[model samples]
Every structure is written in structure tokens, then in C-alpha cells.
Target: MLLELRDISVNYGKISAIRNISIGVPEGQIVTIIGGNGAGKTTTLRAMSGMLPLQGGEIYFDGKRVDGMAPHKIVAHGIAHVPEGRRIFPDMTVEENLRTGAFLRKDKDKIEADLEDVFNRFPRLRERRRQRAQTMSGGEQQMLAIGRALMSDPRVLLMDEPSMGLAPVIVEEIAVIIEEINQRGLSVVLVEQNAVLALELANYAYVLETGNMALEGPASELHDNEHVRAAYLGL
Candidate 1:
């Protein structure tokens, strides 16, 4: 497994947000965590990326225990998290926002090359490279956030609620972009409330309920599961 969560738990102040949840993601595959509102999907991803300390259990990346690593250290280990909200620096130019993603890197030439590649992948970003992020549309900001994460050149991408609050057409665009990114050899662990889209995009799926893992299987199997069909797909 490229990444493994061994009975990981996380707490926020006095509240336990996650409870003994274990998950695994193989190299170069799209894995998804699907859940309803407040089901702890984002909390799970946060713990994996080291944004939240594990209250119990462990997280392993490439076989190294990473439970207590600093958030920046976690990024150095090849995991990049595009958080639920497009948390771009609203006051900065598009190029500057992307630059922040590569803050740990000193290879100026390589960074420039990667920036160019990012621009090529999202031409709209190139067109507005000098524009402030706050002025951009929501979908454009979302694209900027993902493109920024790509600037770090992560082996595994953790995306939280990428489809939230977008129009159907924009959601479709994001889906296509996700497939393109996965095709280019990056592994992804996607957390989404849109179970229909999440199941369709992932190779494997895990369902979380009330801060605990409820079910897990290959995406196709989960899609056809009676409980999943009834709860998530409403079918």
C-alpha cells in the first residue's frame, strides 16, 4: 500500500471527530471516501495529511510511520492536500498562489518548468496569472487550488469535496480534470459527499458513518451494494 491508516483516530478539542478508522490506498489508484454531511470525511483526510494529530493508532506512507509528523513535513513526504474549500490566497496573484505550493523547493529552474506545465494544463490560469485570486470565479479558484497542489509534484493527492457548490457543468469539468490528473500517474484519495460521482471515479471506495468506517470495497461493488444504493444513491 502507498498509504495506510491503521485504526487511526482524531479528536478536535473535547470532541472525537474520527474513531479507529483504517484504510489503505495502493500506488497509482483513485481511492475515495464517501459519506454524508458531518460524517468525518474531511477529518479523516486531515489526519492523513498530518493537519490533525492522531489521538490513537497510526498512519503510514510508503511504509514509514507518519502519525505525529508536522504538516509541512508530511508535505515533504509527497502528500499534497487540496482542502475542502479552495483555500487559495485571495489577495495574491495566481502565479504567487502556485508558488506557495512549492515553498519547500529550491530548484528555481524546475519550479519555473512546473509552473509552465501547470499553466499549460489550465490555460485560463496562464491568462490570469497576474490577476488576484479573489476576483476569479468559483470554478476558476477551484482549478487554481488543484493546479497549486500540482506545483508541489505530489505522488498522492488528497482532495476534499472538490465538487462542492459548483454548477453541474463545472462539476463535470472538475471530474474530467481529476481523470486527467490520475492518468498522469498520481494517486488520489478523494473525499466527497457526492457519492454518485465519487463512486464513479474511484477504483476503490470506503464509506464512513458517524465518525467510523461503515463499509469498504471496490468501487463497483460498493455502487451495487443494497445499503449503499439506498443510502447514498437513493436507488
Candidate 2:
């Protein structure tokens, strides 16, 4: 596995957000966690990114333990998180926000090349390069968020609720972008409420319920599962 969360648990203040949840993402494949609102989907991603301190358990990436590392240090370890709500800097220009993703790196020439690549992938961002991020549409901002994450040249990308609040058409667009990203050699851990879309995109899937592991299997098998169908797919 490129990324592994072994028997992980996390607490928010005194409240346990997730407990004993384990997940794995193999290199070059997408692994998705699907669950309902408040089911600890976001918390799992936060734990991997070191944004939340683990109450118990460990996280490993590229064969190194990283659970207690700082968030920026985790980013330096080649794990980039595109958090929920497309957390771009509202006051920063699109270019500035993209540069912030590369804050840990010193390769100036590669950074500029990566910036151009981001613009190429997100032409709309290129068009609004000088515009404040808050001035863009939600879909555009989401593209900016993904673009920003890509700027880090990460080996693994953790995406939380990438489709949340997006229109159907834009959701489709986001889905395609994710596939393209995975195809280009980045392992992905996706947390999404859209089970059908998530299952379709992932090679493997984990189901979470009330912050605990509920089910797991190859994505195709999970998609056909009667329980997953009834509970998550509404089939």
C-alpha cells in the first residue's frame, strides 16, 4: 500500500469522531471511503493529513510512519490534501493560492513549470490568474483547489467531498478530472457522500457508518452488494 491507516482512531476535544478504522490505498489506484453526513469521512482524511491528532493508531506512507508529524511535514512527505469546502484562500489571487501548495519545496524552476501545468489543466484558472479566488464560481474554485493540490507534486492526493455542492454537470467534470489525475500516476484516497460515483471511480471501496467500518470490498462487488445498494446507493 502507498498509504495505510492501521486501526486508527481520532477524537475532537472529548468526542470520539472515528474509532479503529483501517484503510489502504495502493499506488496508482483510487480508494474511496463512502458514508453519510457526519459519519467521520472528513475526520479520516484529516487524520491522514495530520490536521487531526490521532487518539490511537498509526498512519504510514511510502513505508514511513507519519502519524505524529506536523501537517506541513506530512505535505513534504508527498501527501497532499484537497480539503472539504475547496479551502482556497479567498483574498489571494488564484496564482498565489496555487503557489502556497508548493510552500515546502525549493525547486523554483519546477515550481513555475508546475504552475503552468496547473493553468493548462485548469484553463479557467489561467483566465482568472490575477483574480481573487473569492470572485470565482464554486466549480472554478474547486478546480483551483485541485490545481493547488497538484502543485505540490504529491505521490498521494486525499480528496474530501470533491463533488459536494456541485451541480450534476460539474460533478461529472470533477469525476473526469479525478480519473485523469489517477491515470497520470497519483494514488488517491477519496471521501465522498456520492457512493455511486465513488464506487465507480475507485478500485476498492470502504464503507463507514457512525464512524466505524461497515463494509469493504472491490468497488464493483460493493456496488452490487444489496446492503450497500439499499443504504448508500438507494437502489
- Write the residue-wise lDDT of candidate 2 on 60-155 in tens digits: 999999999999899999999999999999999999999998898899999999999889888999999999999999999999999999999999
TM accuracy, model 1: 0.98
Compose the digit string of candidate 1's lDDT tens values, residues 1-235.
9999999989899998989999999999999999899899999999998889889998999999988999999999899999989899999999999999999888999999999999988899999999999999989999999999998989999999999999999999999899999999999999999999999999999999999999999999999999999999989
lDDT of each: 0.94, 0.96
TM-score of each: 0.98, 0.98
Question: Stretches of candidate 2 above 4 Å error?
Answer: none
What are the clash counts of all predictions, listed in order? 0, 0
Q: Residue 160, candidate 1: how far off, in angstroms? A: 0.6
